[model samples]
Target: MNRIEKKLQSLQEKKEKAFITYITAGLPDMDHCAKLIRAQEEAGLDILELGIPFSDPAADGPVIQDASYRSILKGTNLRKCFELVDGVRKDGCELPIVFMMYYNTVLHYGLEAFAEKCAKVGVDGLIIPDLPLEEQQPLKDALAKQNATILIQLVAPVSGKRIPEILKDAKGFVYCVSSMGVTGQGASFHKEVISYLKSVKEQAQIPVMMGFGIRTAADVAPMKDIIDGAIVGSHFINLMEENQYDLDVAKAYIQTFKTELK
Candidate 1:
């Protein structure tokens, strides 16, 4: 099994929920991004979703969009992201890293070449929010050849019917969007979120991780039984921005969510 699948199985055996943390690469700067990743690993995150900043990130909220813009301004591109990962690996950080990006970035890089680079750079998986299931086969084939998994997203309620098909094609873990809209914090968790997770879990053989709008530990506390993992992006990005490269604060915030899973 790949890193993500193994992580899910380990969590299942331990009767624990996985804590997945998301952060934009080169947010404040590349050095800070590396530091933040290490901090997350030290904080006990099971998975790290490294956002590859794109010029136009349609699936992201204002916070992540702004972070991407800042990262671009600071010279964080696909190639630089690979370099960042290389630096992390050179430093001996072996935690699983998933490249979270938009489809346009992949298209610009050429799918086959991108897959080769990802494999060489040690990326564990890919999460392209804009890539539809129908159009993913070629990229999937390329990544499969290199032993990398593709993580697909399932938006809530409206797309629940497509869960079985999505799961069929999904190799890593299924990212379940916690709300109807884009990535951001919501006032509260909807009752329908749990129902949607139940529907997907019934049909999904792989692990299911919920993201989008989950900001606090309390938001994650109730989800322990319904899903395999929880992904926090906007909130964690917000914390990183506020902390301004102080990885300790980021680690503490992430650890708070990790505490909730227990």
Candidate 2:
């Protein structure tokens, strides 16, 4: 098993759910981003969803969009992200790191070439939000060849009847989008959302993690039993921005969520 599988198994043994955090690569700056990545595992995060900035991120809300824009202006790219991961590994970071990016980045980087690079840099998985399930085969096959990274699938509430099909070849875990919109923190954890997650959990052979609109511990409480974990992106990016990108503040903020999960 890989880092992700081992992590989920470990959490299951401890009767604890996973707590995953998301941060944009080169956000604020490359140095700060690197520090945050290294600090995350020690902060009590089970997995790190590191986003690569894209010029057009349709799935991201205003907060992530702005953060991605700034990272781009600071010269963050796919290659830079790979370098960042490699640096952290050499520095002794053992947390599972998954890249959440658009398909264009991987395509431009070349499928086979990208898979090889991820293996070299120690990326455990890939989450391409914009890539449709119908078109995932080629990329999936490429990643399979390298046997380095697995393609993590996303399923929204509207995915309705397509849940099984989406989870068919799923590896790592299934990213269950809590709502129908882009990534943000306003949406509530209503009964409907919980029901959808339950359905997803039933169909998924791997862990099912809920993301989008989950900001606080209260948001995670309602669906805690239905999901294997919770994913927070916009809220974390907002916290870093609000605190002037202070590493301690970011680390402490993540601890609060981890405590709640425990």
Each model's C-alpha lDDT?
Answer: 0.81, 0.89
Best by lDDT: 2
Best by TM-score: 2
lDDT of 1 by residue, 1-262 (tens): 7677777788889988888888989978888778878888888889999999988899888999998998899888888999999899889887889999988888889988998988887888888878888888888888878876555555466785676777776676788887766788653565587778888888887788888888876786666677888888888888777767688897787788888668
Candidate 2 per-residue lDDT over residues 77-153, each given as its tens digit:
99999999999999999999999999999999999999999999999999998899999999988888888798999
Model 1 CA deviation exceeding 4 Å by range: 153-155, 187-191
Task: Tell me the deviation in Å of residue 130 in model 1.
Answer: 0.7
Prediction 1 global C-alpha lDDT: 0.81
- Per-candidate Cα RMSD to the true structure, in Å, reads 1.5, 1.1
Least well predicted 10-residue stretch by lDDT in candidate 2: 185-194
